[model samples]
Target: MSPLQQPGAAGPVFALVPVAFPAYLHHDALVDADREVDRIGAALAHLGASIRHWPLEPESRTEANAKARMQSWASREHDLPHSMLAWIGHGAANQDSGWLAAYDTAATIVRRGISVDTVAGPVSDEWLERSGDEGAWSIVLIQACGAGTFAKRLIANLLGKPRDPQRLILIGVGSEGAAYLGAVGDALEEMLEKGFSDNDDSITLADFAYRLRAYLGRRVGADLVVHEFAPDGGTPLRRSPVVPGGVTAPVNVYHELRAFLERQPPDVRGHFVPKAQGAELSELAWYFVGRSRERGRVAGWLKDTACGMLVVTGGAGSGKSALLGNVVVHSNTRLRDLLVDAGFIVALPDAEQPPPEVFDGVIHLAGMTTADLVRRLAEVAGINPAARAAADLDALVKALSERTLTVLLDAMDEAQEPAVIAGSVLRRIAALPAVRVVVGTRPSVHDPQRRNPVTELLDALGAGPTTSVLWVPRDTEATEEYVRLRLNGARKAGRLRATATAVADAAATVAGNGEFLFARLAVHEILARPRILAPKQAKALAELLGKDQRELFAAAVTRLSAVSATFDPLMEALALSRGRGLPRSDGIWATVATALTSGRAVTEGDIDQLLDAAAPYILLDVEDGQSVYRLSHHNFREHFESRLAASA
Candidate 1:
């Protein structure tokens, strides 16, 4: 079967028809149009898209001829499930009109060029509407000077015909701006190359548009205007792997993992997350320090080939996830150095040993079930997650047996079915001889009566090493280091009036026996209101320190509420997402905000401001092909829920 017609394929299949009109009788010929078309066609073709080029013959370059050819092509190929129709050449626009120049065209007049109505009129309307109704998507890529005007005219034309604009996606350049030679083609190639480099299986229209605009703005000093009327950021354009069987090369794996980490929200990336310039003086890297003993223990366990699993248990905000995240991001190289420094002789891998492939796996498990875990594992192993669970598990095990694999799984305590994950999926994976697994979770969950998943996991591991992250009394040194670093940073950023050591001492005094999370909050509070550190404000500082974790959180919420009226509703909407996250799409967020606010007017600006204010508490990442906003941690959600309950 043709790949496009295959049954139950993993992603969308595309067919591209690139039409180029390079020469014009009464205008300067588009010297690079043919080459640009070829570049774009080749890029799409490499992604398994069927490509058909229509380069107007010298003898048949008239506008009338072009129209007939497009009409005929549409009649034959309009039934395609996903299609791209690209026109590359001259485009002209005036105050109220736009036209794509045919080879014989002279100017913006419809008599000399193909008008918007001519392209989407009697020949293509029926096909577009019918195909769209059947869930098919069509993208129109017009690379011309006034392409933006063309898009507007095309949209108006469709609307006048009473057609659903959602049937198509339109990509064009600015209405009044000029499109430089090779700009569109180069942008497309770069976008595809990035997706390939990241090991992404597909790129959605919205994602493509996002990248295109960024590329053009950065590289060509041009503008890329896109309108996606289709659902869910328009149809996804799937890309076939350059390598066979979709297996990633070792280098690509590193790039892919790095890209994955970059995509994670700041909080999830832990101490490595970058902070905005206070002269790079406020770098968050300072937040992570003095976990030397824990690092050494984990490294020692990793060096032991006999040990297949290591469990790191800690209370909330005890930095369990941060430690594991550091390891995953840096990979085994940093761990090996740490081990060496700790006086353990680290051996190089033998030539016969397989190359190590590290998978970040799943770092957050708050909403995951056993099935979700299996599917995620399959994805990490480069197997088809859509396959039957048993088949996928077998494939995963077989794949792991052939190579050395290191997997990081965090937040087991947050998973919906923690027991099942700990007792079944993780237990089984840890049994694989060539695999090394590290898991992070709390010592126990809220329900003390039930057997904790950590206990279950430990029981299943038998003799595997376990590490615990204790409360402040044990982690005082680390907390003090963190405070000192943050205060020094504040001084450098000119946010503090006092000396770093003095302020650090004051902050530490207020933090007392609080955990890292509490210390972090306390530091922020002190920085926000530096006067609280004065000797005269000792009682105020004491009052601030008196509040526990929950109280600190409530205070943060109160401050956030003061930022915007939409704060509570936005938080509620995110909580309703159940950790899935709310899309960054304006339409989606507008609908959500409107409903939550009971029809109070909320503009996109309002939403943007709300997101900015909530940045410290929420996570931003791409999920399902679009950027989404998620609560940074489950604790925030729990706190919000408790507040809601109290009000009730």
Candidate 2:
């Protein structure tokens, strides 16, 4: 079976909220949601998906009830990697915001969710951050009138990052008037059940995301738009059913590429494969605040094979790793354009999921020397490494000339045999055909340190590019920008619960400090909750940054659990979610949390207390109408998971 059709890592999306329209909520769906839900369910079943469904009444549609049901559903083990959550119902959207009308929105009841208004959307602040974990397939699909029009901004607010968070793909319909929601479900089911029956063709969610709009326009005669947001900043990697003027390739190209990549085996241990993930592409796209000129110079030089070799040397903790990572991601994007112009195809193998965009092949060398790196990389290029290992590094690279290689050699000083590897090995490899190398290492700040391995390696290589990164200057500017960026994004996501002035003041304080990690820690702690800070709050946050990285991390954790009783439970759940982020586990955590909270007999009230408190810390997202919760950051999951495991 094609990998696209393989079972999701986190099982299948739970298709909840089976009702088309509740009797209450003072609203109704534009289409028959029940019929639409059933259609998608049958399609999923045909595709061999493992999913769960929730049964609830319209009166039970309060935020609290929905939260509880989602928690119960997620607590079970499906032995899958990732999940998708979809909601098909009536939706309201305006220039300011968008929301799915929940049962709580009845005319007789008060609105529970809203940013500026008394009411808000059911989807939570950490929705994007938590719903998706690394290497899992997660999607949030919403179908409602005006959802298509308001989705771009509304989803940005809900998910925080437009791009797939690690693996989560956020998609929605932006509507003009009435939406043909049922048609969307029908199309998805039809195409999926067919399961790329055409050996020469396969589909990615990206294709689906863009194609949905076309489907609505054609089948329903409804004008609509779709957005496939990526983490490479707020700009969506928007796909259209057709590229207005772009070249069309043979349909078979899709299946051929998918089959080629899927059939390849994972790199064996000892021997290695360059991970397509990392090089901080998406993170850089977002957090990279400055050094546009430097990034351009390096990107341009790398694109030109003549200046294939360059070392970006910097002091420890100066953001060298951060800089190099962004370069590769951006460079690849630039290269993709170049390749497309040259009649070469560049694509994301996992679609929607951002792995390295490859033009032939891209490799990053975090560790490994000239010869060993070449031999191993050759294997990835389908070159028989056993046959080529005996040859010199130059000859081995030449054997793989058909494939273009962008080699990122990060932190070379940390690698074994740094001097020999960087000097002779890297120089020779860089000189080879279709190969470009970018290396990172510690700067030689002192004369005696000139004997530093990197210094010696440069001398040996001779006639190459070397740029020293002034950490303080670069990071200082970037920090302030990052603070502004984060805070702004938080406000958009409806997570920033502080006055604008207060949040700005806190950001200024952190930015002025000029230390990268500490600022991040401070922001994650102070802003993680209400998404903002006040004068006193800003001062407390600034102080919490601590003397160093260690103290800062400790401070961050202290804040995580300081005021919230639900923090520990949420952390445990996040850790247990296996990195797909935690789904709300109303059933699993209630009794366990009650037993742990006080060593005394506890009632359901205690569980309620904890769960209620967790509401703020955990993000609530919906898939197929289930309200799921996830931790705001992976570090929180790691920190709490470690604590839980230790206690156990």
Candidate 3:
């Protein structure tokens, strides 16, 4: 069955990278193979293939260890039953029979040098038996010399003698360069392109083999020969029907990259979500975990205090956003209502991309500017847009003269020259009859002085007690509950489950060490795979991610980066475009990319795929009808942005 025709065809692409053997072989050869595997894995991901590169660690280079690895792979419970395996390394015909180097493979007297064990025939007798099914078609590409020999030996071993034709296809080369087998690599890429272009993963093995042969004949002739072999003779190498096109989702609403980002005018919605930002925010508050102390304190302040400006300051992931989220959208009914009665118009602003800090007293607003904020306020207050647009804040204040408004702003510290925006524009508005302002901000971690933006703002606000400054305290119990709630919610939602005990244990143990943001991320990573029911695996996974938030951020970003070529650039631009996250505009990012690097390193041309490629890391959120790109957390932004700067 052709992959295109299958209703839900799927197969994973796996590559086995040879070990960094002793110095005898060109060290570059093994390293080149590693690079090739990485390159191929990335490309295959673009074709919507699930790609996995298994680097044989130093310890796994023993014959016994190698066999164990192969056995485990063949028996693993990966969701995909069919697979495409690429063996990227050296190959040779030792004596008469051909041999492919194993992880522990070394030279014998007649061979290169004693590395480890050599596989001339069957890797494991039960490998075929243990695999999903006889009907499942598997393709193995021996991207090394003596590829044909490895294919014949392995197939022969699997069959023992000539058995019925089983669905296994092998492609290998007769001879290979010290570097990657470029001739074959070109052909492999071509075949994949064709299969992907056709939206079919089910390109027949026979067709692919012929294409490979044709490609080799045209490219290098006899100097580098390519061969395809299979058990039951190499007549027709059939493979599983469901073998391609596993792109989980389009990058965004519009699958087209240029259309998604580069359009002259941004996509105009048929209708806007009524106070969509707040409504969506309220929805997000359902999972609002932790920050109980902060919430309670802020709530108390809101109830008794008739009018005051509160500046919540801390480092990223200090629960500032969550604290603000609670006050704005998720706090208890009493507190939420109290703030709302005071005409709470949230300026939790996000720009399309970080605009230059040009106009003072107001941060750059790509999709929605401060003027837009006033207009929105006018709408809520039943004031006409014309009335407000004519006079700006004067009109807004006059229109809402009766209302004592409390404006909740988050991420004020992120604004470029945020002190200007917070002190001038926000303070001006707060000075109105009874208008109050509460802003959340992060400390500038780089400055030697460790100056808090809020300190300056407090002084500007007359340095009075009315300007309340407080840290969102860290709560172990609250964080632990947050973790447990997420994991258990996943269980309830059917995304994952463990024994109630297992879930509880993981939450308690991991959450104890887990930062609130990191705990949420860890849970997200854990659930994407098969359910971790085994007590040890569950604990191990939790422990693995419990190291530090920065480490967790790195792991998450790296995990997504490996699969997509677009992640690095998108991330770099985001890192540099610090204050307001990268705008959703294509041209802006493309320009930022050109400006930040010698070459346009950040722009993927197709920003959508790059955005899509960097998933779970480059989170997509629509704020006030504008699409915004941001790292999952500010901590990640700081870390990655620092790395980008260091590289430059």
Candidate 4:
């Protein structure tokens, strides 16, 4: 029976198959493959695909059997003619090299000219041409590094057919040195399954392609090698039928690179969420998980407070930046859209650092000193810096505040200037009418007297939950959903090779450290090279840490040291374990806390307190809570414990 004709073959008949090689060789690749399966499954479900999944290899360690399984699947054809897609999760451009490389099987199939259509690359050109010769509807998507360059050849073949040649689209991601394999694969599959999409009448395939290139270029801070085979007037493609409103989202929204010391834009929408360990935070994790609703509440309060001071605090790696990104970016988009919708001047605040000469509306990256903030606001609002004396700055501040204005301050803790002075200036600015100000930071440095000083100055303000507002640590459902979405995206792009379980397990392992930071970083690393960790590397890490959970945690914790210069791993360890009671000695407590917190989890004392509170069971001395201790959860403890050993 044609697989497409199976029970649920209703909506778009889509097949998302991730290629695994010679028996599951790359563990990281396997993990990546698993993500692809889940994602493809979810997307197909969303698009309404009656799906049939077949794993190339079983979970057992036997290689020969797995190879047989792989061969069987490759030869197996669908009973019905439907949209067929496969992800070449792992392979080298060269047929001879790499651990999981299956160049021979793939190459042999191409050489023999077995019949199959709708092929995407990461498979060689030789195979694609043979498939084309079979006269089957072909769309070849490549996940390999340089697959983009092959588009012309594919297009040439399709042009010979009676059908529209436009059915074939090639996308690429990666560097100029290689073919545009990733982008081409991603775009081609999206185009074929969804059809051309764009809401704006002005948008086209060419426009979409250009935008994709532009967005990718902007994100990576570099240009993409987008060469056109047959321009075909590159019409603006419509939005996918699945999503309403059809307004095209930027193709490469997540591509970000560090520029100069300018203020970074806030990312409230969690643009980076898809790349994290799991979508939502796990409650069992040490930190509190937060939600978008909490973010809205805190932001609403910031607007209402009208008083100058605000502070947000949390432990290190608790997602201060992620939250700030959402609050700032989302609000700005909202405000800008509102203005545009209202026919007001669509004046966008410079996302880069604010210049001395102020602008129409205000949006500032956190970390600006109060003095600089005030001066810039005053300058932008047409306040005459020449006429206003230093003291008269308050007069100008009040005048400007009376006008329609909004303020956003991110990374308050990272502010380079004095906190007290910045706080006072903020207070004065908040008191002005028609002013809305939002300030975000880690919770440690908050001091009413030193920061705000005035009663009711920040009374209307509220704290955004670090976990929920920025990172949801315990929401397994959300995490799973997120995992599915991201990995599905990866699979669609053809970079993944395993199945759903592999993706879920990898995410779970990364989440074991139970921190959002690690999960995100791991995803980024995985996407950079979609493959399972080699057994050697995985084993090396395991030898150092033990279980996957522990390894993730220790690696995450260790990573914190790299962020802040102040991390004293020993100090962090001692502080976290303090609840168990004083360890045998003060030196031990200090040593352990310093070792743990100092590395990355905690830096300042207040943050240390929060981190310690998050993992109460870890404390050895619960009674007086004066002694050092460790997490009771074997997974958490073992993870950190291994880190201690690894560091040694």
Candidate 5:
């Protein structure tokens, strides 16, 4: 079979609503429930051609009368055709407290119909067993308070029948006594829509039941219980259709990449393989590999070698660093894995660093200097340059061409601003042929024209408007997992102690920044910060932050101010005119928040002319453009206006 054949159990939906006792609550029932009824009816009508309606009401409330009435109804419906289906609504009574359509009545209905499907509150197990022989599928929903125990019994009984396979599917919420048939009906209706197959008369009914329950649990809560009873069911009970992943740690990067890879068949030859090192690098690599696998669904370039490079880039804390780290830890290659095995591996020239020869077939990290990098690349290739007047760039290119090597230059911006490095050494590295070079950096640090070494490499790698860039976003669960692992390690080794929950909570509270998560200094801060601050103080600080406005506006102002001092005062003037500052104040009422969050201060003159210049970041009323000025996010304003520091 082709690896991409769509799974058979892809789309199925079902709902079962059996209102056994309709009389008592009839008054409270929606009088004009036409909208709900029509909506549900229409959805079911699409299920199949057969539709049956059975209103089995006892003639009287007496014990004898109820028994006879149910027997008669059961007998009549027992002969229903194979394709026949029906809906039942009736006045129901507690199985123990009162008599429902009795055993005889049920027997009669089962005789008439080949399969009698009953959806009601928990009925007597004895009564259900008697009707079980006639190809019956009972979808019972116990909708009473505290009905969990009763529902369990009913589910057990229904599952034990002689005709277990295709004979029954039970679903309920709360206890069996407290179960509501309306919910079961809703699930059945949904399943029928998504799961029905016209080609197969015998469907995989249990699979449908399991998938439906999972779907409902996600939409609501997991307390809703659903049971599928089949002696030879296609899927065993232990093997659920859905596989829940680790909620606390980052998801298995291996699994994610594998899933994507499985979706797109890989070419056995000429594929560009990336080797990563460190926790940060592997995490970043996961992002690229995962996306390549996904893109393989639409295009096959990811599995081909025609592409020279696959650049992974994104914002800080977005998961780029983690992805890179995962790539290296799991890699079979020593060079890639050794660097990233610890989550983040920083490589630079050192006395103990491996000689250039050892990096011949692997990625080599050298000093930030272009000359050193170029020299290392040449040495790794073992290409001896002839003695010449000047060491030409061609000498390095020739060595790289002699062998296939993939160079990973992580954190290019960490060395220096891109502008200074972009033109010379970076350009030279990008110009090399028969070699693959990968770089990771933030979008903010990349400006092509001036000196963005990263962009220069990307442009050389053929990145363009139409080309897709690989990105990794933070995974909260993964962060939690990482925290838990770290905390456990510290506790086992007798570090000053705390519970895992407390540690996890603190770890999760930290901002989702890649640099902070992977850096040794950052990890130390994460571990020490909680110990440094009192729990009460931390809680208070978090609460205060919840109310505070964002500081982006102030930061933006700061960025602009770095270019020209006038920018801060301009924004302040706008806030003052808008009433954030009083005209009577000497200094622009520093309370204007936007100016502060961006670390920018507003001047009195800024308030005077705020309306004209800060239009993009500040909203201006067209009718009275100078009447009010407000920052986009409250945090921005608060940062500029308030003197309080982040408590946490």
Candidate 6:
């Protein structure tokens, strides 16, 4: 079999081909040409690359010799998955084309010692276009003057070819820019070291380009140009000799989790309450307070050697997800302090003991299947998700056995198959050695005639010594604090025309039942119409305060009906979306809205106005570079669907 079809290859293979010319016939010689080549070659070799330097002898640096050597190297390494070509020498460019000066390049070529001929021995842009395989990832690094012009011509050439799956990246200095010898090499080495220390298995070319540009800008204040063709995400340059443990630090995965959560809408993730739209996961830390006792319980669970799993059960919107999100986003120091304060692990001198283990993996189960969960876990664990062996659950469990880590799985009740996830998936994962599992979900309801999914899940887990359940109760104080904070901000912003005493009274009454979801909706209603705070509207405020989540949603819909004629159709469209929200771009929202409204000629402007009127009930987010809209809460969708059913 060919190398491209080779089975069981561990990772991508990298090949480095460098060529440098120090002496030119008519141009000034480069004294550090060989040194520049050596520096770059060393950096690439550190990443496990096979290096091939052209022109073994200084006398053979002519254009004919260089072309032959490059052609031979390409013939041998064409099937390799990744290759980089580095050119360090003088470059000349005109308006339309560019060329690299070879050792024998001259202003005028003299043939037979008498006849003056055209310039010869200069490698033109066409030579580059004819070299290298288009099927493999090809990276070109040019460190010569006018390299940017050469890169532009090469980019234009490749743009005319048929696009391939692999990418071609050209990183070069500006057209008239000059680069100091060893600068590129030093920057690359530093970037690799930092990435490895952070537990990155591979460095993407995009990231490398950014780092290189920043480094050069700070050091020499020069602009580095980069051109990419047939781009397919970020192409990673694999590190040589993988880390021995095959385990990623929890902090790295925590960073990934934070990024994942930020990309999701606040309501879908249940990490944010109402009126805090567009708040990132990092900002949620400010709103996280009064969960000390629950955090202590979690810490104790983590410290317990015998307990393998801790299930956190609470009613809807009782702060289960927010607590978990807080834990995931905490800094290393803060997480360590939480464990030390909870008495789970004692603080010691930095030299005396290593820091305690924080959460290593966190996955939200909404819309995730068994395969999706497995893939996510494998990725966070530093395992190759595409490997055939990773597809099997047992194989994955064995792979994870090599590392000691804790993972948090949130919103189990929201999963596509909650029973399979909680029973089979979580059970197997929790059974692994040195692995701790934390799960968050709603309380199980008992059903005599039908099989209760949560009950079955709990039964599957059993009341074993390794299993523990922590019930989440209403936090009246925390709810009150949240209310006070939000209302005070509204009052300051002139959105609420209530006095300090009135605000305090409203906070107390709203948080009296300790229902966080209800309080959030109630505050939203009050803010929507500040006139409700008037003396004559006391009964209206009292009525609003007395309503539950369903009643509040119904009232909001009634108010929306007075605001927009398309409110019912809009709610129906969002309800029909379920987990996969509707994109607001490319006429998708218009098409769906028009269809739902029985061909009422819905326009983009109408959709925008309706969305504005129904902002509280809507969750707007960006998915795959497009704006998406969904009902803010699953309960809200259920209410809409139930209303539709009753009317039917």
Best-fitting candidate, scored by lDDT = 6
Measured on C-alpha atoms, candidate 1 has an lDDT of 0.59
TM-score of 5: 0.32
Instruction: Give candidate 2's TM-score.
Output: 0.41
Which has the higher TM-score value, candidate number 4 or candidate number 5? 4
Per-candidate TM-score against the hidden true structure: 0.59, 0.41, 0.46, 0.33, 0.32, 0.53
Arrange candidates by lDDT, highest first: which order?
6, 1, 3, 2, 4, 5
Q: Candidate 6 on 391-445: residue-level lDDT in tens?
A: 6677678877887767778767656677777777788778777778888876542
Tens-digit lDDT track of model 5 for 48-69: 2122322444222223433333
Instruction: Please list the residue runs of candidate 6 whose C-alpha ends up more than 4 Å from where it truly belongs after superposition.
Output: 1-283, 305-307, 331-357, 388-391, 445-457, 566-568, 584-590, 601-629
lDDT of each: 0.59, 0.46, 0.49, 0.37, 0.37, 0.59
Candidate with the greatest TM-score versus the true structure? 1
* Ordering by TM-score: 1, 6, 3, 2, 4, 5
Q: What's the lDDT of the predicted structure labeled candidate 2? A: 0.46
RMSD of every prediction: 10.5, 19.6, 20.3, 21.3, 24.6, 13.8
Question: Better model by TM-score, 1 or 3?
Answer: 1
lDDT per residue for candidate 1 within 1-648, as digits (tens), equals: 011221224433566776677777777777777788777766665455666666557546677877766665565453456677777777777877778887677654433567787877732553464453455566678887777778777777666665455646677765554766687767667555542332344565565555555555454453455666654644466554322112111232233334444543433333222111000111122246666667656555665544277778766766676565544423334333433454432333342112232443434565677777777677666665456355455666667676665666776876777777877777677777677767776656562234644455445434533332322123777777777777776788787777655677765774466767677667766776667767777787788778876687677778777877777777777776766666544346546866878667554445556654554565544334344556666676777777668888
Local accuracy of candidate 3 as per-residue lDDT tens digits, 1-648? 112212232434333322322212222235455555555554444333455545555444554654554554455434444455565556565534555555445553225522213432233322344333544444556655555545555555545544422455555555533223555556545544322221122344454455455555555455343333342222222222221211111122122221321221221111111122222121144356555556666666666566667777765555666656545443233323333344432222222111121111211221234555566456545567577565376777665567766556655554455555555556666656666666666544343124544355445444465668777656678767777777787788787867678777777766677556666666656665436555657565755666677777677677666765456666777776663555433245556655655554443234545554444555443333234555555566777766766877
After superposition, the stretches of candidate 2 with alpha carbons farther than 4 Å from their true spots are 1-287, 303-308, 332-376, 379-382, 385-405, 411-428, 431-434, 441-473, 559-648
Could you give candidate 2's per-residue lDDT for residues 1-648 as a string of tens digits?
Answer: 221332222333333323233444566423355566666655554333444554665566655565554343343233444344555555566666655555556442212232222111333322333454433344455565655644566555545534424333455554645656667665654344221222212234454444444334445543354545442222111111111111111122222222333443322111111133232121323345666555655555554443256667654445666566555544455433433453433332321212234223333332334565556456555677565566466666566455566656655653446667766666766666666666666543123223543446455544634322222233566777777777776777787777667666667777766455455556556655573365546455556643454455545546546765654554465446543332222233344444455444333233334434433234322221222334433334445655667888
